[model samples]
Target chain A: MDIRTLCLGILALGDATGYEIKKMVAEGSFSFFSEASYGSIYPALTKLTTEGLIECRQESQSNRPDKKIYSLTEAGRAALEDSLAKDPRPDKNRSEFLASLLFAEAVAPERINSLVQDRITSHKRQIDALKLMRAEEDSPVGQFVLDYGIQVQQAAYDFLIANKGRIVTKL
Target chain B: MDIRTLCLGILALGDATGYEIKKMVAEGSFSFFSEASYGSIYPALTKLTTEGLIECRQESQSNRPDKKIYSLTEAGRAALEDSLAKDPRPDKNRSEFLASLLFAEAVAPERINSLVQDRITSHKRQIDALKLMRAEEDSPVGQFVLDYGIQVQQAAYDFLIANKGRIVTKL
Candidate 1:
């Protein structure tokens, strides 16, 4: 989702700062199907507030910098609903690793092995994160999404392990 | 992968016209991870040819317009190998639908149902495509990648089918 739409959707639940929204995507339940860095989230907030789809208020602090809290306006909710009612964006699982492997014969065997090793390492890390999310999630939908990630990543890891021997033998 | 990189990689396989390159991405084996439109492909080819990483020849035809066939140069092969040796870009499965569902509490139940229905339909179609590809693939790695796509897509379809009732019940 575009960061603006995602911000509106997040605010539909409760108010939060831009940091909260970014964190929510990076490590929260929302990480399942969406992604946005602080770079994109901050700009989206500015745009959303300027467009009046979202409104922001400052929570004053005695010591630290004031926190900017944001929430979706009525128009924002409608906009988000309209988006949801329309067709969902197609899923894109663009993996450069897989693309590289598609021409493994052209690559040095050692380089291919290193690529496979790095992929396994990162995918394992992903599976670990999903397991943590699954442990904390109570909702069925959350569980389902996390489980889906786990299954896919695990299958990839398994496939790599099973095939690594043959793939490396050509080196 | 960037269009330039993908174009380079595609040419590394064999020589082809720009039209053939587009067809390869759309219906050929490369459809799984990378994507390139004619808009991007033509530009990439031009740039690659200018850099001497690839060469193109004009082939005359009796009834058809002359076609430009592209082939990777020796320098292009080295460049492609260099790219493959580096880290592959991370996978991105951006789905606005799942983001919307994360706040399913905010949408009309019927709208949610329709969204889920569309998701299932597309995923099933994706599975069909993968099955067709799987039938023709002989490489173990190719089979693994296709099976991974099929399994992940099937799991998603199954989850939507199994859970759609509760999500729609809120309408």
Candidate 2:
């Protein structure tokens, strides 16, 4: 989905500043399946505000710039609901690791070992983070998505460990 | 990796027309982890040829227009090797399915069931296709990557089937 639709969905939960929206996407539950940077989020928020799907109010700060708190309008809620009703595009697993592995013959065995080892470590870290998130998530849907992430990452981690020797030794 | 690098990698396998390169990405072994469209591939091919990374020759077809076959140059092989030596970016799992499920409360229970069911079917199909590819693959690295794809897809498929009720019933 587009960042605008995602922003509307985030606001549907509660009012948030653009910074809060970016944080929610980058470091929160949505981090696993979606992405939005400040560059894209601010533009999306602005457009959503202009289109009347969302409204922004400036909260004054004593020592800092005013915080623009954004909340969903009735139209925004409708739009989010409408988006959920439509069929989502299929998942895309864009793994540069896997693509690089496709050319494994070109690299040294040491390079292959290091790459797989790094991936194993990365997956472990992600699984741990998801577990932490799982403890804090009370919603069934939230827990379900977390479990999905953990399961898939675990499978990949296990596969890499089990199969690393196959590629490394062959090189 | 960029499409230009990918194109070079494909030609590393053998000389192929742009159509063949597109097919290899869309339907061949690379389908699961990479993507390229004609719109992007053609420009990359043009740029690569100009840069002396690849060379293309036009062969007249019997009934259709002349077909351009591209092959990697010495520089292209060197470039592909250079890319392999660098660290790959981490994988990105952009799943609209999971993202939609995150806001499951906004949609109907039936919609949730149908979405999950469709995902299950897609994963099953992917697993079957990957298995077929695995049989045809002779290289250990090729088999390794295919196995990774199948295992992960199986994990996702199983997860959705087992957890569909959790989200649907709550909604």
Give each candidate's interface RMSD in Å: 2.5, 1.7
Q: How badly does each model clash, as a count of residue pairs?
A: 0, 0
lDDT of 1 by residue, B17-119 (tens): 9999899788766776767789988888999999999998999999998999999899988888888867887787777777766666554545656667788
Candidate 1 stretches greater than 4 Å from native: A62-64, A161-171, B62-65, B138-140, B161-171
Tens-digit lDDT track of model 2 for A1-171: 888878887787679999998998889988998888999999989999999999999999999989999998988887888888888898888888887777655433446777788889999999999999999998787888899999999998888888888887554
| Model 2 chain A weakest 10-residue run by lDDT | A102-111
Q: Tell me which residue pairs clash in candidate 1.
A: none
Q: For each candidate, what is the lDDT? A: 0.78, 0.85
**Displacement of the residue B74 alpha carbon in candidate 1, Å:** 1.1
> In model 2 chain B, which range of ten residues has the least summed lDDT?
B102-111
What TM-score does chain B alone reach in each candidate, compared with the true chain B? 0.88, 0.91
lDDT of 2 at A42: 94
lDDT score, residue A47, model 2?
Answer: 92
